[model samples]
Target chain A: MATAAARTFALSAPLPLDNGQSLDGVIVAYETYGELAPGKDNAVLVCHALTGDQYVASTQPLTGKPGWWERMIGPDKPIDTNRFHVICANVIGGCMGSTGPASPAPDGKPYAMRFPVITIRDMVRAEVALLDGLGIERLHAVVGGSMGGMQALSLAANFPARAERVLAIATTARHSAQNIAFHEVGRQAVMADPDWQGGDYYGSGHSPDKGLSVARMAAHITYLSETGLTEKFGRNLQDRDAKSFGFDADFQVESYLRYQGSGFTRRFDANSYLYITRAMDYFDIAEEHGGKLADAFAGTPARFCLVSFDSDWLYPTAESRHVVHALNAAGAPVSFVELSAPFGHDSFLLDVPALDRVVKGFLA
Target chain B: MATAAARTFALSAPLPLDNGQSLDGVIVAYETYGELAPGKDNAVLVCHALTGDQYVASTQPLTGKPGWWERMIGPDKPIDTNRFHVICANVIGGCMGSTGPASPAPDGKPYAMRFPVITIRDMVRAEVALLDGLGIERLHAVVGGSMGGMQALSLAANFPARAERVLAIATTARHSAQNIAFHEVGRQAVMADPDWQGGDYYGSGHSPDKGLSVARMAAHITYLSETGLTEKFGRNLQDRDAKSFGFDADFQVESYLRYQGSGFTRRFDANSYLYITRAMDYFDIAEEHGGKLADAFAGTPARFCLVSFDSDWLYPTAESRHVVHALNAAGAPVSFVELSAPFGHDSFLLDVPALDRVVKGFLA
Candidate 1:
């Protein structure tokens, strides 16, 4: 069943960004599950990943697909929306009913490349504005995974009083060189597409689908564990007894990745992909707080719970331990665990019973 | 100090391929170093990796750069060219003077996508033909790393008596699902470019350089270890005091990757990249030998040495161990070592002093 209708809230004033620019007339699109308590103390904010939107426990409007975290957000699920109000919003540089590069500028044209570059902290500022408009000065918990995990950490660090408990899964406080390198490849792929037309392809009939698909294909590989891929596809042929000795998808894994890539282009905007990835690349909480991670959590009252998947090379358990060590140095209440999973960085979005238990227990 | 000039040998007959097809009028491009023994037993056949050429111990004509294995070859080096006759051949699908997609087809046009797909064994077959042309009955050794390693393994498995020793470094006997997935991404990136023109970019004035650059960028990341990247580039800015808040290469890693991507497009052919990577993905010695790896090495008299880098996730030590186990099962003499190096799959190409000793001792 459809869980909740999408809602939007416009900030009364410009939202200040880390890049020394202000985003004007910003509108945050969000979805809520369950009801807010009378004291507004039972509100939980769930941030989405790089490509995720606001359909936390409902069907996505564009793809008619179930919410990314549908398995963990319903009644009696890990998130347990019946017990607490759950809110999820599309990030600022996103395209899903949010103010982003696809939004119209003062000239009544899509901002396209003119969209101000954003950072993880800038996204949090927009989220905080949304929270302020909702009359919720504090969240019972701020929870996320991947890019969302970055946001969870950002809110806890920047707006220390906004979240009482923070749960960040499979994430890092700083984007590594490898991470930036991968993102740069994707960006270059999109920009290289003739159809991208300098990111001004809003109504040009043709978009950088080919390049975006390639970008998605590359990113999809990072989301999966080598063991998981070997177990699922191996050297299996793609419905052929012998290789066609051509450029076609001969291996099942190749076919699967191609499908993943092409399907992604149908629902994503190339410009938004660029903007979001740039935001992630600029994320460095330690650097933001005078180059000391411990200083980022100083005087924060939030109880932090960090979870990592063993197979996630993108944001490995070592990154989580780094954060935990910093929290320890900051004398903050923090709990950390590296759960075993074969899904890599996508484990948080996949069916991992251990992750479900961790989320449920941490929230409780 | 010019080691040798390139030479080409035309196969006397059509070359039989693994896909039941035949390649006609094939020409193998190669180079030689040092003097051949009167008995020809001092001959060493070196197989170059993807994107490498026959300029093994000389300056590459196209880029004016020293050979890929320059440090490991030449007089007094580990391979000791002064004491052994070294021969390196560009593979069939390569872009050098070899017969490849860029070469003229039967109709006097570039083969483009019409070129038949090749396998690692097919590549070994070509090398065997080159040896036959040179009047060499057997090789003192067959040496390679990465895709080159695949060819060395193929030579040992398919032509057991042709080589007295086989040295394979930082490679796998079979392309894992992850390996195939990454290659597939690179392939898709190339094909997505309009300039690719279905691999018919030859003589088209413009090539799919953008797409190939993106592909190279992605592959470049897999070549380096995370720890190495952190130590080399980290989140350091690129000649700047602050973030640019734009799509420019603000991070040093991004700038480095961009330079690498652009510089590669100059000296490489996109169509050759597609064909070579395809050959690599199709590599599966176990499958080629009735689903048993040991069967591939059955009765092989060659002494084998397999080297892997501890940080090489692309083709980790486990893959080498698998080959070693199979060699043991076949009662073949085999030695394997996983050297501690931070360079990942590129460790074999980098300066790792331990590797030099191992290669010298193995060849001796």
Candidate 2:
């Protein structure tokens, strides 16, 4: 049920990383709902995107906000917690009680910038370890949207037999150049702040809240389409009869974005933001496997469902098609569909009946 | 031809503004090229967009960079200086040798945040005053792209008989909600910095360079299409074998964007950015005319050519179509075309041969 609390798994051994290094004192924060079933075959793994945490169906402790995907992951929803056990993990390099930039180092100080750079594969590897610790051998399905979708694909490709079904919604196998550019802007914004103090702002009187807010504000625009913004707030003045003729939250859209950015800083660690975005930018599944995308899933037995939105210019339908093509070439069972949604890249997070139907049908 | 310098015309009369205020001691920075014919029928008004100056066909004095529209306004080019007398003026709220936020107030101090908020209509009005000062009765054509296109439309609407032909390229009739949102983000970024000092950073030790750079970086991405960035950078390392596993400029695109952001700070004044962007955000021709877009151009005598780039999602083909439909309803002679270009919203400033053809054909 939604009342579940977050739990953590600590592994004694260091986790090997892709960058020829090992991460010590590994920890994964996770939550589970419903019973695992006698065969442990009813377990579904849900991955989170950048800035997302393990509280998929539980209330977030810090902000008291409902689970990010509550509408789709409820009892009778598409994910159907009543029908299956759902496991969601706060990823490595994540801010939510996971072993990340904010976690203590060997010397009892926060890792901060000293945290080892991680890859998407490393995050999945941690998830696998968490699964192993939980005594789960196989997953019924691996489901995620956006960055979470990347994790779903990675789990299926590298550990082919772990999950029988994979659902990737509004995601891509690699980060596009524009994606990296946007991330770079955010990172620069964070670093530019004098308060950042080279990522050592843990005990500082003030955090890089302003810089981080700007970073979030810049990144937030990409999550929406032009038409969506126009329809929702077409030059609509915010609580004013006329323009203030000065810099203020004059437009409703500006006020909304400001709220999103300010609210993010309250729950997120700036250093973790830097680390997670870096991991995403470095995510190129095919680049690791000889530049041939199909090779990553060469022997995968997982059945995959790829869902994309028409207005998702961030990771458009073409990106999903590329993944489906790779699955086809690898002789894997795959279903691909592009749906119409006006919300753009954030469509997967919004209430879309079509997305719900697709998820229910695929998981069934 | 490129050796011409920017000249200023000081108007003795106060200029009226939409905000029920008047701008006093107005100065218009302008430049002219080619020769004025005996009948003055070959005079062309070239409007500059946001951040553009009067150095349309001349070298920019500040950066030593070539004119922004050198390709279009050169002797042998489409808007050929040899064929027509071209006049380009920096808008009133601009920084380059124009009366703007950085310009002295009536008492001889920089206006800073005290500068009167101007509008697209006010900018066109200033250009009209300049034309009157130059003794030009009518323009053969008024040409512009992006914000320049906004100026072109404003000129045609307010001063209907000033120009015979109006060529607005890769632009919209007014600022969309998304457009205002992006500009708001930039303004916020500028104001977030302590160095901005409440928009009076003139004598400050350092300008809000970091914040301004971040703003430029955000705007720069919108000016480029996804495919263009992917082709140009495509995760290509910037002088490195692999990502440093830290937040350095890992990709070429990041480096390129950083350069654009940082370089822009040296040449641009932060206060001018806020004032100019505010003016753009306030632009709404339809809202001004009893909620009818056609009413803005009801009795216009200008022959219009509307050009949109296929990749320019900022001001997409639909936006140009809205203007064209208005022109049709207004019974104005208008031609509309959507051309293919990979440069997104900035295609008009780039070397697009199709644009050249359009300009030449429209002018002829």
lDDT of 2 by residue, A1-364 (tens): 4557569999768999988999999999999877778988899999998988999988889989889999888788899888889999999999898899889999999999999999999999999998899888999999999999999999998999999999999999999999998899889888887889999999877788888888898888889988898899988899999888777888899899899889999999999899889999999999988999999999998999999999888899999999999999999999999999999899999988999999999999
Question: Candidate 1 — number of clashing residue pairs?
Answer: 0
Candidate 1 per-residue lDDT over residues A75-126, each given as its tens digit: 8898887888999999998999889999998899999999999999999999
Report, to 2 decimal places, the DockQ of model 2: 0.80
- Fraction of the native A-B contacts that model 1 recovers: 0.98
TM-score of each: 0.99, 0.99
lDDT of 2 by residue, B80-123 (tens): 77789999999988988889988889878889999988889999
Candidate maximizing DockQ = 1
- Model 2 RMSD in Å is 1.2
lDDT of each: 0.93, 0.90
